[model samples]
Target chain A: MSVSTSQALDYLEQLPVQTHRKLYEQPSTVLAIFRCMLPHLAKSIVMGMLYMPTPISSPDLDAWFRPSAAKLKRSSLEILEKLHIVSQKQLDAVKHTAFTLSPGFAKSLRQALEGSGTHRSFGVPAPPTSARKVSVAELDDYARIQWESILFYMVGSTVGFHGGGGMARDIGKGTRSLLEAGDFVGKKFGGGVGITRTGFMFVLQDTNAQVWSLLIEYLKHVNQLGMSETDVLSFLFMLGSLELGQDYSTSTLSPTQLQMLIDLTAFGLVYRTSENASTFYPTRLATTLTSDSGALSATNNPHDHAPAPSGGATQKGFIIVETNYRIYAYTSSLLQIAVLSLFCKLTTRFPNLVSGKLTRASISRAVQTGISADQILSYLDSHAHPQMQKSVPFLPPTVTDQIRLWELEGERLECTDGYMLREFPSDKDYRDMVKYAEDLGVLVWKDDGERKFFVNRIEQMQEALKKQGQRRAR
Target chain B: MVKAVRGTLVKCDASIKAMLVDIDSKNNNDFIIEELDEEHMLVKETKVNALKNRLQQMMKDRLKDPTIDEDSGKE
Candidate 1:
């Protein structure tokens, strides 16, 4: 089956207890899972438990989380249990149940967090040599220039434009072929290959999400070719944890991973000096896979593998859509201007600035191309100037509402895929289960008179059934 | 008869025929000694007072040794 990232994550989540037991034996895997898969508060909880001397009482844990947030706490715990990362035991002659990190996870996490493991999962840095040393700035410039060229290549062909040799040739033929195969581009009805609707959406996403979206697409195709999804995923995680400036030895990687390294290098996700170079360096693009924009922009340390200079935080957002539909952007980047031009009609272009306006016609044209106003608004929101972010609402609420309204006009009735339950044994049983659904935040729609209800997620229902079983046992 | 002092109380005995001023109380400056008992006015150093001083020293010594005081209920 073709496994997307979400599919890969679901596969990881559904691993049998025995598989998790075996996987937790590897410190690298455990550490990688903890860093990437856990939520923000869950990470803090895990860290706190890492060094505790005694099994924490459930009541004590409850006190640790706010009352209103108890549902989140319980869900976090449930996921941890499913992953085999934690265990709860009843104390002798006492009603209290104590929770502790599972021994395997605990030991592995301790090793990973302390950096004491001899496994050397983190790639070894190359020996100091001036000839092959890659500065972070050079790497960032390489990544940005290459990535921008790809966007320009796809977008340029759409507008009957030419980037001459500067942009078109930088991206490899393999990537171009894959883009066409993925339907991100198509053979224009009139003439040359042109951008597709998905192509516009892809171009509009922020760099981080765009990387994820593209990599997910890549992962989906890799499975069809019979590559091991496990090897690809673990290698991607390992790449994320590697130091940005340092080169890593490729000897430890599997053949699939090694091949991936070559393909990734062309995409500017990693760098190597020569085909024979002993080491390879993951670029900032690869390392920032899991970081939010706040971490990306706030940590100004260049050595930390920030994709863009912290100073560029404000410069990235050039477009400001006012309630009156006027748009102003302060950018000279041709790639950004080209993407904006896909949905907006540009009226003026200054030396350091470009001005555009969003009109009903322009928005409707974009909508006709399958690019919703939500995607455009979110794209604008993600790249909003740091100055704009300081305001209470990043975009003018009216503008945001109008964009949603425009998108909503096309989606008069939203469709949801879920399970519906009815005909319970009794009204009391239905009432109790419905109440439980509401508590878990999974109840999408319910009809009391009809005794029918719908839920989008089902994990909580399984637990609720177990509780009912216990009540009957009693 | 003894002669009286000119300003304050006078203490006089018939056999002594001399005057002495009484300054103990301001109520009367002049007075004559009638019958005095010298034996009742004698001063003495007692052993009981020495025992009180010894008791105070013992309490101070006990306070200096905290462990001993803590165990012995000397506080």
Candidate 2:
């Protein structure tokens, strides 16, 4: 799983069980969740159990994995159990444990993999009509224009690059409010909109991650808009599963899904010909939601056949960073340029290329804006020119390290939000709990002398404590 | 050991290369499955069988007539 998928999964795992159960009813949703949300080992386990007559016994499951991978297997199963995708049944007398896939998940995933269900949740393709069919290229153009308009609106206003003459001025009212709602942008004292820290993070991300971030924001606000969250989510998943070139009909969608289509269209996720168009097309942005961000920037957009002037050899990557902190980007896209300007002191611009230098002042300015050096480095790394990709780190080590060093100069203190455990009944108890928390990968800090520790998450630690108590009692 | 798995699978069946590619595409390059031994292949085959059975069960649950057995092995 990539960062975006894990982020989505984190949101999904927080929902109520009823919502998860309802979501599992859709084959497309199940397929999308399985394809992107689960870890590699979890997917393997699910696939291994999909067609079995009997639940996989604990010993059998353990034997399937190498001994060295026992920890990974345990963690994967832990996540699977937590998500209620798989349940464990303990056999009596012999005390053997067996794992079974949740019936709803199994059925839906099976239907999805075999494409056997008539659920139409995968989306119903629009029947061919003579109503001036929109080509995929046109849809791509529409999506790019609408998406860039939103991005430029967020970036241009912050950097004081006014006179966003045409498209940026026409950003939909719904999108503006949504951005405000997500705290990606805020209204200034002078009645003008300004970008927020979250907005900076959003801008630095690749296009696919940016789209997911926006949609996830939209998902958070669905309930207040009188829309069913499950329906909206399943529809979004369906959009992710849809073929990029094909048009899906709106007739089969529920009222909630239909309402979501309007918002999604404004976000440039799905393109519709007009307000009441009968069919909608999923853009590359939408279709790549369930894919890793790395694969997304690497693959060429099939609809994009436009000639690459220079660094546009890759679909979205155009930036080339040298060890000397010199940056060259071959992109005429204003949104890309605006984002680059946030952290790079751009010196000159050609027809399809822009050259810049990463200076200490520029790095510190970006860091002050709440854009971390890591984010800037990752953005540059992901957008590195194909020629630069031939090297191991993609970006030069000196440049990446220097950016971090510059940011580090601005601050000293680091903070983490978590619980600190102290004053245990005994040192042994503290040691045990600390070790357990450490094993769970949640321990942040510990003091052996004080018999105290801190953990990033307490739920798992609480559970371990309870189990330990039970064992002690036994 | 890794090379042995790749050699065995690649030498035994040319079709497995296409199957590996399909898996790779589905995974979105998170990790590539470049090799599989006969033992692992058998394990996967059982999983495939389990999936087929589950699909049949799903057809029974959802379909009125339940005559889609021919499409079960399509994937």
Candidate 3:
């Protein structure tokens, strides 16, 4: 899944069953969730069960996959269960348990796929208007400008770049507070709101994911703003199904979604002439929200995971690095320059060029702000100049190696995502389990005194504990 | 009766752990769920970002930079 899909999926998976049940009422929302928010395996499982008359038997479902695919099947069902799309049942007539699709979700998805619904959930388009018209190209440009302005505002907030004042300063106060609420930018040490680590990662994500990220944050505030969360969500899903260049009628939207139009306009998801416009157009950003990685590769927006585009042309990447660690970027975009200055000690700037060096202090400073060495290296790799691409690794090996070494200088801690096991029944059990965990190569930290341990992987340890229980019973 | 708590295990130098403990104390002990050993901690997954920001701020104030900007070539 693309970052955008995962962002939406993560948000969807956390919603309570009641919310999901309400959200699944809209055929468009159901379709959008089915298309983008589910794992491929989950999608197949959902489709497989959609039309089945009876609850699928556990053994029958298990028979569908090979033993090698057990892990994937397990995770797919886990997602299905989490979304409340599928639930287990004890059949009165049968000897074993079975699972069936949630009736509402199955019905809505069927209606969405078969075009059998009069729900009017997809969206009602305004009749073509020659009086006030916007073309596709115009919409794309508006999105690029509006989206880049928000990005520039973020970049400008960090590092005190005050002179790039045209569009960046025009970001709405509502959007600014949303950024603040998301912890993208918090009050700095001096006075003004500064970019935090979450903000940096948000800036670094691809454009589609950035939109989802911001929108997910927007969803959190929908409740506080007295807007119905289901209405806001279904409207967003409806926007993804909208046809670009076709104007959508504001009369058909609920009051909450109508309010959303003004905000979505600010985020470049929709284009509107004024706040009171009768019609709004979904930009490229909005129309691509439901695509599965197609949006990521379709536009090749220069502000993506690589360097920001400047004076757009055949020059996709412009940053060139030397073995001596000097860096030269042929771009005039101030946003790109600001991003570079985060990690490089820039020395000179010409009309269309900038020169900088990756110094230890500069790299460490960047790392200090929570940008990882891998993020830096991949950014360099993606932005490697055309001539530099002829080489195997693209980036100068020595420079890349030294950059990693510099990052490790300030790092005295490492983290493992796992669990802390404690409350053992006896000291003997603790010693045995810790020994088993150590032998499994999953032991991260252990304390014999407290009869507790930390393990990076817990599945095997859980199995061992179960075996120990059985042994005690024996 | 073995019990396991789901969290992220953080292993660091004793000095860094001290700083982390200081950060946790200042935040009403919101970041860390438990301190398991001298250098091991189980931290809340969601509060990791807040902890990181605090640590970065702490480090920036403590560490002195040796490199000075010599950008005399700018026009």
Candidate 4:
């Protein structure tokens, strides 16, 4: 599971019923979660049921998923239920058990997909004409400069570079404080703000993950400040849906949202002329939040020929890695170079190129900063060049295996944080439930005589048990 | 598999209904043409009768005009 999902689910769990109701009032949030958070097949199930009048019978849904995909289907449904996006139902007349989307979620998702409702939650396009039009390049320039400033603010103080004079802008104090609170930067024993392990890990992430990581941190702080989490979350989702390069009317936003717009502007998620710009334009960073990791990977790597516009806030990768650990990055962006420098030992530099080797030293230095080898490999794989993308494996096999092997040198034990279930009434019940859990792919461990089972994801275990009982009744 | 109808909203609907409109002898001039009054909407011939007659007359007028003879001679 990705960090975003666990974090998102945790946030969802904390929401009061009323908050969920209010959040679901806007269809965009429903659509965003439906599109981005659900597994591939979960989406299929949701769409299949989105228009149907009756609850989807549990048996029918079971039949719908292929036998081989039974586990995936069960896991998917459990996630949906846990998030309160769907519910299981029993109607006495038919003696049928069915699954249905939670009413609020169903209605809002329908509105989102159909683009109906007066909510105007998708951000009303600046009423057909706004005289002050901003070009995509201007927006990218704004995003890059603003984002780089924040990064520099964090990394600069450590390297003894105080922004090197007259940059486009310096990151604001609030953002710096938030970063410190998030532990992205820490006060060292020497009393200077030093880039922490989390910061290093953050810097190496694809731009999309980086954006989410920062925003999630910001969300936590917002919650701490006695602000409404629902307002902050819904506003963030609304920002994600806004069209890049088009200004959105701020009049319809809440006070918390209005405050967020300013903070978001500082982080380069949006652009505005003044502190009180009537309308704000979301950058590509803001808009691509709901896109899948695959799309995120494509957008980040320019050499992948993903057709992302050059001047937008979309990330473009230019690095090529080989099985022999040789690396060639075809870019001159200073920020990119700085990031690469963090995890790769530089051997040469050309006018429009940089050559580096992923040596043990480089990998260990990064691992020491709390970035795992898997993170580095995944980043490399995602940003692999187009030619590399065409191959069966994105990253070179030798390099990928070696990175893991090196990390294994440091990591000897693996730990899973989850719950254990035991003390079933009978062996039959235990066996039946264990199989159900296994089918859902949530059974981490089980002991036969002990009549005990363990599941890494508890949300699914409960659903499986409920479903098993429904099945037994028949 | 169900084929999805795709396009601007108007064109999607237009593609469904426009098959009935007669274009062969109506001069193919549809510009500025309002959809024929609702009562005669279903009958192709009745809807196009006036436009068809006007088109034939215009073509004949163009052939008979003296300016047409002069333009052809120059060419």
Candidate 5:
């Protein structure tokens, strides 16, 4: 799973079981979850079990995987168990274990794969009517304009790019308040909004990730809006499954989903002729929700004229960074230029190209603004010129290393939110607990002499302690 | 041993090609997994053999009569 999908999965796993059961009732939702949310190995495991008549025995499943891959298998199974997608059973007096897909998940997934269900959850295509049909190209243009307006709204005040006018002002009130609530932007002293650190991180992300980030934030506020979270989520998943450019009827949507459609339209996930339109066309942003980020750039809307430095219909990279730290980007979008200027000492801008240099001052300023060096590096890497892509470590190793060093110069201390454990009854117990925490990958720091350790999470450690207690009792 | 290795490689290549074809049929043509070269052939051969064995086991299980005791053991 990519970072965004894992975040969504983490949120999904936290929901009550009833919500999950309800979500699994929709084949489209199940398919979208299967396609994007599960780890690659977990997907394989699920697919293997999907058509099997009986539960897969633990030993058999273990034997299918290389011994070296056991750790991956364990973690994948752990996530599956947590999501209630799979259940384990002890099959014999000797405690032979078996695993099976949860019935709801298996049935819904089968229905999705077969495309046999009467469930119109995937979406119902709008009937041809007097409503003027919107072209895919127009929808793409609409989505990009609406999306960029929101981004420009966040960035314009901070970068003093407000003179462009009207574009940023067009961002809807609901969207602006949502951005404020999420702390992506804050109201400034005298007047307008200022972009926050989170906003900087958000703007630097690829469009698909940015959209998911915003939607996930919107998901957090669903309850406050007096809507059922599951219904909204299922509708979002359904939008992901919809074929882009096809108009889907609004007739079938519940009141919550209808309200969501209005908000989604503002975010450019869906396009409608007007608020009262009976049908809406999902933009590329909506349809590609469940795909990996790599797949996103390939299917970027043909009419998405965002002057991103890479990968629209042209299939060419636009950003080139030299070993000497000079940078050039072939883009005309004010939004992209503003994003680049956030981390570069840009000196000149031409009709189609912008030139900049990555100086220590610029990088440090960006770091201080809460944009990490790694995020900057990745943004550069993802947008590196095709010529750069031919080489290993796309960005020059010197430039990448120097940027990290600059970030490190900003601070000498690192902080972690966690708990410290000390005062062990025995040295042996402390060693055991430390080793267990290390295995769990939660141990942040430990000292043998002091018999003290720190862990970022305690739930798994508590379980380990309970098992240790049981062993001691035995 | 050489023949077994060769056989496994051939089978692995065929299965992988089949899977790629399946993916392509689904319109996910962007992903193109290249065939294994001589350098990695031996490693890939073993991996494929393991997968083939698991697949055969799955097929065998599918052909067998359903076991009623399987449900009785569920927690």
Candidate 6:
């Protein structure tokens, strides 16, 4: 799974079971979750039990999966159980635990797969005779322009770059406040924009992940707006299933989704002829939301291979770096220039090209702003010009090493905000809980001799310790 | 009973840890919550950034910055 899918999946998994049930009522939402949210083995498990006449016994599941693959089986089943997709039931006749796919999930997923449902969860297409004809290229351009407004709002303000004199000023009030709430940006000392660490990471993530991150924030604040969370989520999933350049009807949508349509239009996910246009087209951004292609590889043309970026924008890798650390980029897009200006000290700019040099001062300045050396290097690597692609390593090794050294110069200590675990009742208890914490990926530091450890999280360790305490009392 | 203390864990070399301890002491003993081991210590959660800035300033005063061609290296 791409990092983007994991993010959305994490949010979905945390939703209450009741909300999951409501979300599963929609075929499009169910289909989107099944396609991108579930682990590979979980998907296979779901498929195996999808049409089964009876629930499969837990022992039978063990029989199906090889014993050597037990861990994978357990993990996959755990995820399925968490999502309420698969429920364990008492087989009254057999005296065993049997797993059945949740009725709502099974039915909706089946409908999605078979394309046989009256739920009309999928978007209703606009009539063929409709005058609005949007080409895929035009849709891509629109999506790019609309998405850039949000990005420029976050990056431009912090870096002191104004995205002057365009529709960039049409940044919606709803979107701006959402960014602030998400800590992607905050009002600075002078009442301008200050990019928080979370905001910096959000801006650096790929276009698709960026969209999901913002939409997830929107999802969080939906209840305050008196909108149904399921309605908003299902509409987003419905947008994912929609075809690019194809227009859909607004008449079929609920009021909350209609309001969402206005917000999503601001985000550039869907485009309409006008504010009141009855038909709207889902841009490349919307179509790629639930996609597994990783980044918003909006271009339907498969051969356009530029392994996309967690960098700012522009899919075509346009940067070229020399051994001396001087850089040249061929592009006229302000968004692209603004992103480049994050790590490089630009010396000259022409209509079609900009020249810059990576200096120690510039890299350190970016690091000070919470942009890491690795992010800068990956941005360079992924966006390396086509000519530079002929080389073994995309970026010049010397410059990359120097950039890392400069970033490392300022780093004296690493700090993690968490709890330190210590003073266990028994040696065995300390050892066992430390092992569990290690497995949970929360153990920050440990000393077996001292019988104390530091952990980045505490709830699970607390539960284990409590259980151990209970066992001792028993 | 296993006890968990809530704070920010800082990891550095022994020298840096000693410097942090000295810095914390000079700051009226406000930054550190507990010192766990040779290279690890727990400090006040909200004071991590302020402590970082202090460390950076001290390093500037104590260590010589070795960048020679930074200005002239750029085009």
| Highest-scoring model, DockQ | 6
lDDT of 3 by residue, B1-75 (tens): 788898888888888999999999988999999987788889997777678778978987988644434423332
User: Which has the higher lDDT value, candidate number 1 or candidate number 3?
Assistant: 3
Candidate 5: residue A299 lDDT (0-100): 43
lDDT of candidate 2 over A63-150, digit per residue (tens):
8999977668888987898788999998765458899999999999999989896899988899988777667667666666777788
In model 6, which regions exceed 4 Å deviation?
A52-78, A86-101, A130-132, A158-169, A189-191, A194-196, A294-312, B27-29, B68-75
Query: What is the CAPRI rating of model 1's predicted complex?
Result: incorrect
| Of candidates 5 and 4, the better by lDDT | 5
Q: Model 5 off-target regions past 4 Å?
A: A52-63, A88-98, A128-132, A163-169, A293-316, A385-394, A422-435, A448-452, B1-75
TM-score attained by model 2: 0.78
Which ranges in model 1 have alpha carbons more than 4 Å from their true place? A1-26, A48-68, A81-104, A130-132, A162-165, A177-198, A293-299, A302-315, A320-323, A330-332, A347-354, A368-372, A381-398, A459-474, B1-75
Error of 2 at A295 (Å): 8.5
Task: List per-prediction Cα lDDT, in the order shown.
Answer: 0.66, 0.75, 0.83, 0.68, 0.77, 0.84
- Give the per-residue lDDT digits (tens) of candidate 5, residues A1-474: 677777788888888778888999999999999999998899999999999999999999998899977768888898888888999998996459999998989999999999887988899999888867787667766776778888888887788897573456478889988999999999888887899999999887777778888988898999999999999999999999888778999999999999999999999899988889889999877987887743235544455544433223223477899999999998776777777889998989898899989988789889988999999998888888888899998999999999999897654323344555666767888898987777667776666886766677777777777766666767
Residues A218-279 of candidate 3 have per-residue lDDT tens digits of: 99999999998889999999999999889888888888898899999999899997779898
Could you give the candidate ranking by lDDT, starting with the highest?
6, 3, 5, 2, 4, 1
Q: Which scores better on DockQ, 1 or 2?
A: 2
TM-score of 3: 0.81
Superpose all Cα atoms of candidate 1 onto the true structure and report the RMSD in Å to 1 decimal.
36.8
In candidate 2, stretches whose alpha carbon ends up further than 4 angstroms from where it belongs are A54-57, A89-97, A165-169, A293-303, A308-332, A347-356, A384-396, A423-431, B1-75
Give the per-residue lDDT digits (tens) of candidate 4, residues A122-206: 7767675637688665776677677767776666665555544444255888898999988999998878888888898777666
Give model 3's DockQ, 2 decimals. Answer: 0.64
